[model samples]
Target: MDATADASTRKPAAFIGRRLLSLLYDLLPVVALWFLAAVPFVLLDVAVSGDVRHNIGPFSLLQWLLWLACWIVTGLYATVSWRRGGQTLGMRPWRLRVVADDGGAPTHGALWRRYAVGMVSLLVAGVGFWWAWIDRERLTWHDRASGTRIVRMSKRN
Candidate 1:
């Protein structure tokens, strides 16, 4: 078999450690995005409220909207990166790539599903990620829901 074929056929690596590391790396850019997204919301609040507010109020409408915007912006970053290259900036360092369970690039719909499920998984204190430890195939909740998997790539010769 060709080198590419051999690499593609390998089972996904045990991923929890690498996935967490990648998330830590990805956090930097996502935080930057959150700050950028908050800019307009902050400005609008300042204009309307006429107060120099350092932060949005707890449970307020504007605060919720800002949270939603950050979620969307983060999703855009993740989905676009996955769609274009199957690897986010974070995943690159770990040699991880997201792919369909069938070993092909996932469709846009699947990618979005993956993101949404992943968000829920994170919100639940990453029970989904922990589940991979016991899952027979080492699949996370998002992986099962979205029909996708993250595979670690072999080193290039």
Candidate 2:
């Protein structure tokens, strides 16, 4: 068990602004991975033809494939981070940690669920994250649905 796992009783749910900021920070790595994910498509395109650009149109196969790749990469990054340490690179600097209902590191299944639900929340204009402000415990929709919560780390004396 990680030391931060025992924080529910001592630490509070993270503020929405903090969560948003951390997400913004996390996007840097995500975008980098996205670019990496595009490499194969570019390589294949170049090998088959002369151009290496992927046209992102409504009916573009390359676009769909790239989207899938990006989703898988994002899920891997989040799930691994959540299951291994309960924090991502962004969450680390912000002192945010994700824990299960029992305040332990989330299970793999829970982490995946959280990632999927989080995507849904984001797709819906972040209504789920906003739900935290009104939720009595300040848990987001994904957190509640996935049986997990993100908490602010307490200061260590």
Candidate 3:
């Protein structure tokens, strides 16, 4: 009997719990960023027309750009952090890690594929995100598509 190997094979439930916590942590920063971006439009309306009811067409373009930028920032954050550190800021706080199916740092290609698929999942009524809840293995569609897995990291051995 290989005791050490057996111990290492146990599932990481704590890590998953931590990962969920980290998602909440990350959400705070993302929402803050969204709010900051929205301020420009608010200010533009006040400064240009001095009327609350007035609509600024140029500001609308800026708002759209801000929205797009937010998505790009989020995707890049997830991809770069997951590939380099095995988790994002959110995942780290929760002590969750992401790895390739074979248990290694994901390649850039794999990260991008995961992000792209994740976007598609969001477009498709968020079925991909919800997949994790129903999946026996707790994997989302993007995770399966990218051959990635999210594991909970534990403090105690």
Best by TM-score: 1
Which 10 consecutive residues of model 2 have the lowest summed lDDT? 3-12
Residue-level lDDT tens digits of model 2 in 17-69: 89999999999999999999988877876776666564455667877888899
Predict model 3's lDDT versus the native.
Answer: 0.73
Query: Using Cα atoms with residue i matched to residue i, what is each candidate's TM-score against the true structure?
Result: 0.90, 0.88, 0.68
Task: Provide the overall lDDT of each model, using Cα atoms, as 2-decimal numbers.
Answer: 0.89, 0.86, 0.73
Candidate 3 C-alpha lDDT tens digits along 6-104: 446645323334545676787877777667766776787678779887765655775677668778777777887887888777776566877777666
The sequence of per-residue lDDT tens digits that candidate 1 reaches over residues 45-151 is 98888888556788899999998999999999999999999999999989989989878899999999999999999999999988889887788999999989888
TM match of model 1 to true structure: 0.90
Candidate 1 ranges with C-alpha deviation above 4 Å: 1-10
RMSD of 1: 3.8
